[model samples]
Target: MSFQKLILRLAWSVLIGGSLLAGSTQAQQLPAARDTSFTVRSAYLKEKKNRPSISIAQPALPPTVQASYNLTYCTLGARNLQLDIFYPKAKRKKGYPAVLFIHGGGWRSGDRSNHLPMAQQLAAKGYVTVTAEYRLSTEALYPAAVYDLKAAIRWLRANAKHYPIDTTKIAVWGFSAGGHLAALVGTTNGDKQLEGSDCNTSHSSSLQAIVDVDGTLAFLHPESSDYQVSERPTASKYWFGASQTEKPELWQQAAGLNHVTSQTPPIVFINSSIDRMHAGREDMIQKLDAYHIYHETHTFPDTPHTFPLFNPWFEPTLNYTADFLDKVFKAKRWAAKLGLSLLGDSEDYTCKS
Candidate 1:
């Protein structure tokens, strides 16, 4: 292994004076954990790949980074839930702030690999980025994808040490269908109904921040924009398994806007100016303002639905996202959770009073 890969390996090893192996990394979040403990899943680290040098801010460095692909984060009913992880070799003992990238396909068809270019670009900029695959509506339904991503979050935290990651600074970025999932994961932080079974339950699925690009926020609309939703079964039927009238509760529950609270993480909405995708956005922004949580929005006038994920618009999308995340990662709430690098040796120092 190269030095970068070696540093990553050292980072993953059991931290000295910490808990034993095999336990979940829940202790990273909970204070007085009677059962929760730091953990290490060696299986996830067994495979790693080094890619060619990719230039970003400056000229190319010889050894750039490595990507660990198809690493199992969870397994449910004959399918293995996996994710591709990319981390730069720019050694940071404090690890890198991670963003779990979810793809978009109306909650039915989309592969995690679609975000590979985005992940590589983001990773080159100094953040650990993960592109994850979740159980779709076909394989599951309603909150199964939610639970899958949540489980992925827990699994990521569980294996934080193995990769250069800051457990507290985790964020989520999604486009379209993935955007809804991202919003769901970000807002439904503590709700147990959406949280699924047996995937690293110890750690939090809640995000420190989110980037929702043209996702469906509120299904309930009052004809404010060009888009329209039918009262009968429609696009959402694939995921919800019923029409809005048949399962009003499920529709309401699945709307990311309904779950937003004062505690919802800072978010940026990169939307197409003509799109009505953010149906309940104004109301949710009011809730966000009521709580004084940081938020912003950037709309591309006359752009298509996938503008944020494509060229031209994608440039601004990347800038806005990176900037927002850079700021969010440094916020007091997230910074306070920094283990060592962000805090430095001073965290180990105490006054000799």
Candidate 2:
């Protein structure tokens, strides 16, 4: 066996051996412990130190946007999955488009609160925005997070009447690990296998668009950082419950790139200079092109992986995200009115450092 495969084999053996000794029943009784090491403040501090002038964006509810926090969207046994919604207090005749923001923490850490500023800002722009919390790798495994995110989408649709949301115009935007989930949720719309059995099954979980902020599209792709096997167990390993070698199929199933089809919605990629953060993006874009799907890519040079949480890059990220959503949703509204099938234009732009 190859060195990488050997290491993965050993890692799996150690993980399984430890779990067995701990007792399966004992493990199931309690929710897995969350990795709380990663947070917006920690990320901001790290990035701020790297660049002295950079500032962390504070979360604030603008006067025009009203927010409802800790609203339960789903309940798994004893665990209550919650989300925060920020929407314009002013009503609109046709209803406002919606965007669900997912925060990234390698699937093991980070909270929905990380994206509060983004959600608040987007709500001020006349879109109903949500920041949702999901089961992390510590609490659940691979498909659990996916299932929870889909439920959040369905929850939004189910409560559209209450929130004045234009159910037809909804998008998912996520950062890092959350970005991976967002893309997976966007591509796997209507996919029965990934769609969990519970939580507002009557309402569709389909998304009109996806914004993946530096999230990898494919976990198993050659260009992916996830493919690089290590002696120590990685975050993906924890989430998958095994090494890539032990569960290649699970890794591939979780990859958004594997699920892309003609019916997949338009996607915009906002990436930092880190190439590893966007592994499998180019290949996914190729698939998007084959299907004539609309997509855009914006790369910010010399920025941290968590650039969206800080200033300098933060405003640009917000603008790009809002502009892209408006373009896609507006085109959809026009198409619906005119009865014309239209796909928005695609572009690739790089922000100079």
Candidate 3:
């Protein structure tokens, strides 16, 4: 094994013995060369001999995740919003369930590449994952990012046949700023006002599931300002164009919690127990309850705001995510066939589509 691989393996072995890490998690083992993977290995990769892979399922290792980057999904004015698509090369009888990932940089700044590892990990688990770029505070403000996301979803659905994604099985996943957008997209289904007339306008922007990691749900709430930052243009200020005091209505509109209704999709919240990082979450949970929406929350106790971006925490974070998606997707299939609502309410989302 390569020296790096040896160190990682040993480190994992010790970590596993501590029972703090998921024992089933394994990375690709570098071959003294390469085999089993159908694609040609680069000289550098082939020399490693063993590539490390990890799996939460029965597979010995992660499936080969193929990444296609910088595919333009939509263009608003001069800005060309793009996405990086990641999926396993393993063919299936039908299309794979897909998830659109949004990155977190307080919404002021963040590139989609930050979530490439996440896209690959999700793709390895038999899902088509797309990490997309939307307008930032540097480019536009408020709903522009949300509109871009909705456009991307529409674009994905319009090209679903070519990409082989199950149009009926789409979800949105995001972290922090992306989390808020994902939640907004999930809750605002059928709202034409937010669904900008971008590419693939005919396709629906509705989502079947949402994964929010430490995202804000409402700017109107007092708890929303829990995080104090020194960035010249704070995320909220830049995104909203002014303080909530100056434009309360616009701030409320930008917040996802203000839009949650019975039509919202099933949502799973992965967060740090720090509470404020997921400001307005409990309030939204209460709203979801009142609306009879299906939702779940997984809080990582005593962790930093960057829990989802790093290891130890990342494994369990993803494990919960994969498991939640699997459960929701399976139930969604049955809910559609039965013509029943997955949220245990009268709203038949599957049938609506």
- Candidate number that wins on TM-score, 1 or 2: 2
Model 3 root-mean-square deviation:
14.8
Point to the candidate with the largest lDDT. Answer: 2
lDDT of 2 by residue, 1-353 (tens): 88988987787677655544323434433546667899988887777777998888885679999989999998766567899999999999778999999999998899999989999999999899999988776666778788889999999999998998998888999999988998999999899999987789999999999999999998887888877776567778777877788889999999999998888888999999999898999999899878777788999989889999988888899999998887777774544443335643421111112
Query: Which TM-score value belongs to model 1?
Result: 0.74
User: Would you list the clashing residue pairs of candidate 2?
Assistant: none
Please list the residue runs of candidate 3 whose C-alpha ends up more than 4 Å from where it truly belongs after superposition: 1-63, 226-233, 332-353
| lDDT by residue (tens digit), candidate 3, 188-256 | 888888887778888888888899989888776767672342223345765665555656777778778
Local distance difference test, each candidate: 0.68, 0.84, 0.71
Per-candidate TM vs. native?
A: 0.74, 0.88, 0.75
Query: Against the true structure, candidate 1 has what lDDT?
Result: 0.68
Cα shift from native, residue 346, model 3 (Å)? 12
Model 1 weakest 10-residue run by lDDT = 35-44
